[model samples]
Target: MIDDRILVKNVLAGDMQAFRLLIRQHEKLVAHMIGRLVKKDEEREELCQDVFLRVHEKLGEFSFQSKLSTWIATIAYRYAINHLRKQKIRFADLPDEESFTKHFIEETDPESIVEEGDTDAFVLKLVDELPPQYKTVLTLYHVEGMTYPEICEVTQMPEGTVKNYLFRARNLLKEKVKKYLGKEELL
Candidate 1:
């Protein structure tokens, strides 16, 4: 794990290795947020690069207020949302965030568990189907292992809203996963 203090210090001092290390440590977090928001691969990749470049430029202003990851994720969120707006991206059938069924399936066949290697990818696909806010909350909270306050820092949502989004996203995912596993009838 890269130590935030040292990495930030070295990065500010013009150490190329430290800069690379910072990117290595936080690139996945940026990618997850960017991937969730930006649909086009080429555009996503460009946005990701842009995110790091901005991070590099702004490293000097980083106050030790929250975890470095949270700060980076906030930047990523703004950039992706800005990109989405600039491109005027449109969806024909955007799912309603309020439409998620409360009745999630509780059980699946023991044999239905995904093969070990593919489970993460499978879960991510299900997560990808979530509405943007829910998915961003889930990724920042669960995937990035951030606390509610940290999530709030990145998302600008109230603490209660963060908790609600996390709960609702999980419930939505559970319903979808169980349905995918042929357990829809059991819900």
Candidate 2:
């Protein structure tokens, strides 16, 4: 794997291949961040392209204080949030855990559960229903394997908030899955 500094330097020196390499390295990070935040199918691809465009435009300003992927994630997050605002999407806060758990389990039909029976996908669907903040923290930390500090940098949340979000998000998911399994057993 190429070192980030060297790759960034190469790209800055007008190497098209290195620019492509940069995209290849960070595209999934951008996609994962944007994918969790943006729900519209038609807008996703265009949003991703716009993210890379911003990255390209701002490449020279990166001071390397954070990992390139983290920086890129920050950009993707900002773009998604802006897009959401443009569409007037509300950024919902996570409901109270007890109420959310109760509602989530109750809202699912057995047929719907069985039809989308894969446990991982089912868990992801539940994750998708979470507030944008929870989903972003969960995806960055768990899915992208970023450390808490990295997530903090990406979301611009304080360490305490990032940790709090992670804890709450995990607990919420656990409760939902437990209730889901219990209902699954009864059926």
Candidate 3:
């Protein structure tokens, strides 16, 4: 396998095969990120294409200051945010920060535990319920395992803001998972 940097250099030097190799290597990761952020199947497909297209267009600007994955992730993050902004969804329509916590405290029944076969689907559902910002932070940090500094670079937010976002996102997820498992017995 060619090193990612070599693949990038080859692509930059007009090797179309190198570009294809790069996409094949990272397509799954890109698809997963796009899938989590864009709820609609149709929109997700389109957004995934847009992300790769943007990556190709911007490839010449990549300075190798970060990992290729980090650069691709930044493009994916920006595309997702732009899509959300164009949708004009009100943040208030999303469950508020307090309500998410309250749901954890109020909802709990043994029957509510995520069934073994449904864990992924259930978690995805819960993630879809988060506001755009929290969803972005949660997916990038937890799902992708990017560090806070990487996330800050991807989202163009301060390191402190990235930490706070991750903190709040995890807390919200904990509440969601607790509610899924039954709030009363989670303790």
TM-score of every prediction relative to native: 0.81, 0.88, 0.81
lDDT (Cα, tens digit) per residue for candidate 3, span 20-44 = 9988887876876677667898998
Note each model's CA RMSD in angstroms: 4.7, 3.1, 3.3
Off by over 4 Å in 3: 90-96, 103-113, 182-187
Clashing pairs in 1: none
- Candidate 1 residue-wise lDDT, 13-80, digit = tens: 99999999999999999999899888889999999999999999999999988889889999999899
Cα displacement (Å) at residue 74, model 3: 1.1
Model 2, 73-124: lDDT tens digits are 9999999988988888866545676787677666754346546667667778
Shift of residue 96 alpha carbon in model 3, Å: 4.3
Off by over 4 Å in 2: 92-99, 109-117, 183-187
Query: Candidate 3: TM-score?
Result: 0.81
The 10 consecutive residues of candidate 1 with the worst lDDT sum are 102-111
